[model samples]
Each structure stands twice: as C-alpha cells, then as structure tokens.
Target: MLKGITENAVQSLIASENPSDIQFDIVVIESNKKQEEYAYPCTRTLFPRKKFGFHKYFNLGISKTDSQYICLANNDLVFHKSWASEMLRAFDADPSLVSASPACSIHHPAHGVDLYSGIHEGFEVRKEVAGWCLFFKREMLDITGKLDEGFTFWYSDNDYINTIQKHGLKHALVSSSIVDHLESQTLKSKDEKEQFKLTHNDRFYYEYKWGKRSLFSYLNIKRKLFFR
Candidate 1:
C-alpha cells in the first residue's frame, strides 16, 4: 500500500488485504478534488462540502461507522502486512487497553505526554500516540467522548491523552502493528503565514483547555515547530 494518505492509499488498502470484515468510510473535508468510486462496498461523505480542521472529519467518520473497533487513520500510510492483526491482538491481550497507535521508529517529536521510547518491537503502554493514526474500541467513546472538535488543527492529540489519563485508561504503541506514516504529507490548503498563525492560536486554545505551559516550554515547542 502507498505510505501516504491519498486516494491511492484507499485502493492500496483494498489491494493489500484479503477479503475480510474490515470496512472503509472515506471522508473528504472538501469536495474541490475529483472523487472516484472504490470497488469495495463503502460509504463516502463530502463533509460541510468545505475545508475544516482535522478533528471534525474524524468525529464525523466515527458517527458514520458502527464497527466495534475503529481506527481513525490519516490517509497517507503504508500498512505493513501485520498491522491490522497486531493492533487487534494488543487490545485482545489487554482488556484494560483503551487506545492504541502503530509505532513509527522515526517520530516527529511530541510534547505534553510521556511515551515509550527505544523499542524496536513489542507493545508498551504510553501516555499518548501520535495523532496520525489512533485506534481504539468503540466503547471508549462512552468515557472519552468524541475528540474535542475545538482543536482546529493542532494539540487535539494532547487533549486526547489528557482525556485518557483522566479516565484511568491506557494508551499503547503496538510496535508489531507497523504502519509507516508519511508525516506532514497532507497537502496544506493554507499559506505558510496563515498556517503558522493558526497553529499558535490552537496552542493557546490547548493551554486554555488543559493548563498553561511555561514560557520556556512554549518556546521549546515553537523551536521544534519552526524547525520541524
């Protein structure tokens, strides 16, 4: 499968796996791009028929699917052969595990959550996983509820971690469930200045929703954001 979330990624997902119970509900935020039909029996939605922030799409997708296990994945990912099986096994092995994300050795530095590091393989409990792909049981919604759609583009992952922690839930990174994330591969509809402004604005909202970060901490994140 293609490594980045794109139209071809859906086709690749279908091509990689054998006939199974898995289903896809493709949600496009804006309808400016051309749409095509997939061979699989799936639903498609052009939400708001316009561009919006990330969490809104995910919330809408969850509402549209009734699967017991839902994987909120970005379109740009290359699913290794065992990705699905390993993720499911982690949940099966730990009934208390409420959420998970497949591991990527090359990580984009995440702030505000303690995570397991230096593992080439195996499952490890974590405070959070990168937001690129988050998998969890449907019932988790009962406790954590839908992702806070207020996170227009950033810090929703941190908010989710806070939610999981508040509810005494465990989030894990399943190393064997490998999915290569194409980081920042999604097309940016906004210009650089506007994107930067929106990101900082989101950070302020994050602090307001959670708690304040020190000046140094905010500066550190700013440096990484600029360089990354």
Candidate 2:
C-alpha cells in the first residue's frame, strides 16, 4: 500500500498486526529539511512543500505504481491480512468493476448511506466513495484522467468518482475485505478557516460537475467546514 506518512503514525503502523505482509511505500509529505539521515531502507520518503496538496502527493505515488490493480489508500488505515486477496477476487469476478472500495462503518452524510454497509454480493453503482482503501483497475487512469490537481487537499477522490460515473463505469464495495480507518488523522491539524476553504472548494467542484447538489451534500459540506 502507498501511504503518505507523517512522523507521528509510522510507529503505530509498525506495531500493528502482520506488518510483514504489508510492503509500506511510505512517502513523507511534510517537514524533512534537516532529517536526511533518518530515512528507513524500505520507506520511500518524499518531503513536499506546504503548497503541494495531498492529491499531488497521491498522484505522485500513483504514477510510480506498475501493478494492474492499485490501492490508493491513506496512512491511517489498517487492513486485514486477507484484504489483497479478497479485493482481487471481487475485481476478477467482474471486469466491468472499474473500482472497488472497502466497506467501513464510517458514513458520509452527503451520500446518505453507511459506506461499509452498502457493499453487496454483486456489482452496483455508487454515488460517493472514500479515498481510504480505494482499489481501482489501472486502466482507469487512461479512461477518466488523473486526480484533479486543482484541488489542494480535499475532493480529489470525489472528483475521480464523478468521472468514473461519467464514463459509465461501475464501483462496488467488497464486503469481505475490511480496513480500520483513523479518520482525519492527516487533516485534523488545519484551522477552521483553512478547513472551510477545503469544504467550499469540494462543494463547488461537485456542483460544477453534477450541476445540482443534494441537501445532504450541502449540510455535510457545511458540517465539515464549520462544525468539525
């Protein structure tokens, strides 16, 4: 898995179960000016400037991947040992499934469904999906284009999901595979004003592409911006 690592969470991941099965290609996204010697052998480190957003960093990792199936995941997510195998089975069962996301308990109010609970035994269309543990066919890069660089930190995944739907591609939840997500671990440090900008920009992009936004979407965006 490709993880954008901050110094804080690296130790916890190492201590988690079955770390050997996980080949962590860790990319450091911030504050490495004087820390050249601290890099680990297996860890692939990147020290991006504050101006570059998570989408840019994520795209950097995606560009380097050679696997036919790619998992674009966050560092805070912990996976089951069987995650890779089960997800592959789901994708292999239907070549039309452009993407398959892991089911989790966390619900985004905008989508009006608990993401993990929405997983079915068969294929289906999904309105929204989280960036954490999003598995996609490599060909999707050529089909929908890369993540929108215009987005600094948020909504890049949502934009990609929108593009997937536009191409009539299908996405589903692989119910058998699960990942524990430590929500907002990366973006939790941002102040209210910066957070608001992220939310507003996300909503604007959705409205620009879809032409209409749902009430749940509006409220969710507002909640993310001002409330938390």
Candidate 3:
C-alpha cells in the first residue's frame, strides 16, 4: 500500500483486520516533511511531494509491487473480514479474469449510499471499474501498461478499464466481497472549480473513448454515471 502520509484511514483499516492472516508488506510513501514522524518498520519512500495526482501514486505503487496478484485500493476503503479470501477464490476460479472488485457501498451520507445497490453484476469489458478497490493479476501490467499519467485528476480508472478491454481481458465483481468506502476522502473537492474540472475530465474520457459510435454508447454513459 503506497499510502500518503496524511492518510489516517489506512490506520483504521489496519486496526479492523486480523493482523495475522491479512498481514502483508506495506510501503508507505510520505512527504519529506513527514518522513521522520511517520516512519515505521515497513518500506518508506519520501519525496518533495507536490500534488502528484492519483495516476502518479498508482504508478509508484505498481512499481513497488512484485506479487502475482496486486490490489490497488484507496486508504479509506474498509474491507469486510473475508474480503481477501473471497477475492482470492474469484481469481482462482478464472485465470482469465484480469480484475476483481468488491461490492462497495458509500460510507458517508454526503457521498450517497443507494447509488451502489445491485451495481456489481454482469461481467463485461466496456463497463467501468471503480478504482476504490481493484484487484488484478500482474499480467495485466505487461499487457495493458500503466494508468495514463495524462489523467492528473479523474478518469484514470476509465482509461485503465478501456485499456484492459482493448487487450481483451475480463473483469468481474466478487458479489460476496464487500467494502465500505469512505469516498473521496483524500481528494475531497473544496471548491466548485475542482468539482467542475472532475466532471469535465470524466466527460472527456467518455467522448474520447466511445465517440458516439454505437447506440449503446449513450447507455454506457448513463450506466457509468448512475451505477458505476
């Protein structure tokens, strides 16, 4: 986990899970100013950080991971106790499955909760994969390459999912696996401009990828907005 120094949510997640079974190596990437105070036994990377964005953080994490199966998750996501086991089973059942995501429901009322009901079904390539919790085989890295660094703010997950589909890889949601997502904890938008920019980025990604070429394209946009 390449967690930012300010992420207290990581501590909450660590406290919730069983230390023995779910134990894995952690790599905390912190700002240079926080290097001394946040230091722990786990691997640490300190940089003169300045708004590197989500894609950059993801790339940094991917570079550090050597495991065959890698999970890229937000620090604010709280996994169900059996999350790891269920995800493992899903992956084992189908080697072709490039990515597996948990059934996530929003934690904060401001983020809205009912938006997630019955959203995790039907395995298809064109569908969006929520970045909050994504588990995938390392082979995908070799195939689809890294998240597009051009996406400094939003739609990085959409770009990745599109790349995965282009490579003919499959993805599914582990219906039994659940996660409580404290949505947008780290990237909270405090101004209208930030919110508008995020929306613009999302729309740009959709238009660039789909381009109104098919009848289903509009439906895809609606599905992503309402369900994904």
- Give the top-scoring candidate (lDDT): 1
The sequence of per-residue lDDT tens digits that candidate 1 reaches over residues 1-228 is 222246555565555445564444555344234445333224364535446667877787778778888887777776666567777887888898878887654552343222234222213223237577788899999988888987877776777777888888888777666666676554365578767865785787678667686656766676766675
Task: Indicate the residue-level lDDT of 10 in model 2.
Answer: 55
Q: Estimate each model's TM-score.
A: 0.74, 0.69, 0.69
Q: In each prediction, how many residue pairs overlap at the backbone (N, C-alpha, C within less than 3 A)?
A: 3, 1, 0
C-alpha local distance difference test of each model: 0.65, 0.62, 0.61
Model 1 worst lDDT window (10 residues)? 118-127
What TM-score quantifies how close candidate 2 is to the native fold?
0.69
Q: State the TM-score for model 1.
A: 0.74
Q: Which residue pairs come into collision in candidate 1?
A: 4-76, 5-75, 5-76
Model 3 lDDT tens row, 1-228 = 224423554554465457676665555555335445555443454453665556777778778868777877766667666776677777777777778777664432233323334334334322335567788888888877887766655666666676777777888766656666766754563366556555555555556555633546655664665543
Q: Score residue 101 of candidate 1 by CA lDDT.
A: 87
Candidate 3 to truth, TM:
0.69
- Model 3 is weakest, by summed lDDT over 10 consecutive residues, at 107-116
Q: Identify the leading candidate in terms of TM-score.
A: 1
